[model samples]
Target chain A: MKKVTQILSLMMAIFFLVSSMGNAQSKNKVRKMEYNSKYNYEVATIAVGVDGTKLVKVWGYGPKPEEAIRHAKELAIACAIFRGFPPASNGAAAKTPPIVTDDSVIEKYAEFFDNFFAPGGKYLQYVNLSTDAPPTGEDRVKVNKKTYKVGVVLSIAFDELRKDLEKEGIARRLDAGF
Target chain B: MKTLVNFIFIIALALNSFGQAKKPTIMVVPSDRLCISKGFSQTFDNQGTQETLPDYKKALQNDGDLRLVISKMSGMMADRGFPLKDLEQELKNLAQEAAESNMMTSSSSGSAISESPIDILKRTAKADIIMDLDFEIKRQGPNKYIVFTLNGLDAYTSKNVASASGAGQPSSAATPEILLEEAVLSYMDEFNGRLMTHFQDMFTNGREVKVMIKTFANAGISLEDDYDISGNTDMLSMHIEDWMANNTQGGRFNLSDGTANFMRFEQVRIATEIERNGKMRAQDTRMFVNELSKYLRTNCQIESKVYLRGLGEAWLIVGEK
Candidate 1:
């Protein structure tokens, strides 16, 4: 009986260890998926301002409209830095080049980006809602029963954002003199 | 140790300032094809053969739209801190110079020297890179759009260093200028990025130029002549190649063609600057070839006359001064 109890305890310990390791690996995979999804959708420029600002429409997906709308702001900033707007049919999209071309920069400066993109972080200072309220009608869509796809138009202070990145050593300055 | 540290710090500061001081000068011009298609070209007799060339003076003076476009592009580049040599302004300067030259004649021969308009512009501007712009406006029913192309070419070699092209979205009431501005805004950054890369490469690997070597008809020496260098017999051409290998940046150069009397060294990577007398000085094709000419004269007892065409090409005529 004693031997059986000892064996049972040992088996329980092994099971917990294995399960925790599996959970950690799956968590990393989920994090990677989330990061990639932020850049997967297309961002289009609605209007370009002469004062170094760009009004861009970005799409975000979440379980709720409010969550998706919030996520769209983050996506707007991310697309500005990483993935520039793609050309759309009938000249709908203004195919602006991204401020930073190297994608590996995210992984290289992971800590910096993580903090810069945190909730209510420095990225917020560069982008704002072009309109007073969240977009409705065609801009917001219910994808299936569990998810909402929301498109938000945000005004991004592109030049200021680029200067900030340069200050932070994340992007090269134009006048740095090659 | 303390004095050495101070000396090192000063040196670092000077080097940093030197790196920041140099930026490529750029000029924007309408592409030759665009000028021709828009009927802004004129024919001129070149050695008895009539050749059509872009008449930049006429284009700049007659086309208000072209002037506006050039100004817009120049403004954009200026915003990025690039020094721009305005094409229209340069053309006017050339015209003024031509008028001044035409008023004067040689006292002995009663003749005046003439240069082609393009040559005069090249000598006057000396732009490191030329931005060639071409655009077309297309209409679809009631909507109009613009497809534009921008190419950055090396002023000396005419090599395409950077290029960007795309079509803008159609609009019902957008003017050609608006469409062009929108189209270029998307790709300008990438184009400038490429231009920067090329300029940086020039600093690292050296500025590329072309060198040609020729022997005068009456010269007794030829490139095939054998030279005794430290008991090793090598041809005169071999000796010249060795010098090029030693002097050029990373020994980077191509001997494209060689014969008994002629040698062509294309893509010769020469240093942009060199340290002399404990000071860094700017270098060019003339200075680079002058060093080679000196080497030939001092070591091989050969005299050569170096004739430079523009800033990137040099011809060394052997056996003569």
Candidate 2:
């Protein structure tokens, strides 16, 4: 009977059980630690080419880091879907339907892992790591569609802060020369 | 005197014959159907356009340290000998298990990093083995743009201060989402690759095996919440394992890119039994497990004990992801 029960139970488990039972420590572990970020400034301004190097800005604002990450992912997807990232008034607005709901962009990004564009970037690699040397103007990075020159920066906003904000002017460098 | 010496020699020989710790036959192989890349799940839509991360919050929430977790998690699966079939099958099983357990089957989900410090040589079974890999992050400076230096930290506990691991410190620009992603991804790559390898090996030998991974980590998204400092190791291990032996691993994970998706454990262990043609004695199976454990201890700092059970002429296996 014991062996039969074991077999039946194992079979039932095999048939239906999805998650294994976990008996972890009862106490919840919550550690609060902070470290200096290595990536450079945060604010980034991208130039939209066509109407004489006009800057097409992708605005990202959030109260928490989750919100910030969520915002950043949305902006990345928007950049990918739209022909010119942050399609400025000057450049063309190539119509492409948003891939996911406004609420589910981060879930999409977390589905995979890779840094193919980082080292292999030849055009404009806009890596905004929390480091000292933030990606700067005309730097090279690889976008989903193609690579381009970009101006990347990282910074933390403080109260009554100075205006480190920026604007850019761009046209399809592919068609028109700088 | 001669008899006494002989007895001592026999005991010493017995101890020495078993040898060292056994390395896990673990691998994180790529799924033949999907590839996870850069916290993004890429799959061709009916229109042939790549369906990428549309929900950035889901992406960020699940983007728990892809690179760092892959790198560090590889250490847990350093044995490099698990059948590839076992790795792949087990990872898939664990995923199905996730669904069974009613986890956040949201389109994209990143699990927590919970470490279980089991007794090195505790009660381990041969049919199913359990292990816990613990890691901590260290920062070199402060601010959102500060440098982060990682190291293996040890947790300490006092009367008031329960414990600390490595160099636990606070940062000014602490983003729970970012930190969780970084910590989870840093050591998970090894797991992804190994899963592929382990499964490949299992299938190659015409044996069916399973690998279950139990994940432990924090869930809060606030910098103020100490998600990293929490504990859920044992429960996750057990839960994840239970999920795998059952067939149900397809969650919302898109594996087209092959880098972002990883193994998650709820509260169970991964159990895969191979039905082979031959048969073996229980003692012999134990001996093989003993040998494997001995080999692992020397090659990788995984575990100190091993268990081996008989299934026909084969063995059910478990290892790190």
Among these predictions, the greatest DockQ belongs to: 1
Cα lDDT of all candidates, in order? 0.79, 0.29
The best candidate in terms of TM-score: 1
Q: Tell me model 1's lDDT, rounded to 2 decimals.
A: 0.79
User: CA shift at A102, candidate 2, in angstroms?
Assistant: 35
Q: CA shift at A80, candidate 2, in angstroms?
A: 15
Error (Å) of candidate 1 at residue A132 is 3.4
Off by over 4 Å in 2: A1-136, A139-178, B1-131, B139-171, B175-178, B205-321
Over B201-299, each residue of candidate 2 has an lDDT whose tens digit, in order, gives 332332222221111233211112221112433332232223233432222111111111123222121112222234211122344334434443443
Model 1 C-alpha lDDT per residue in residues B1-321, reported as the tens digit of each score: 999999999999887655442355688888898888889999899999999999887888897767777877777777776757998888788778778877888889988776678555555545767898888888989989887788998776769998877777788887877776666665566577677667667766888888888998887889999987667689999999999999999999999999999999988998777665676666778778888899888888899998776567788889999
Q: Deviation in angstroms for B318 in model 1? A: 3.1
- CAPRI-wise, candidate 2 is incorrect
Clash numbers, per candidate: 1, 189
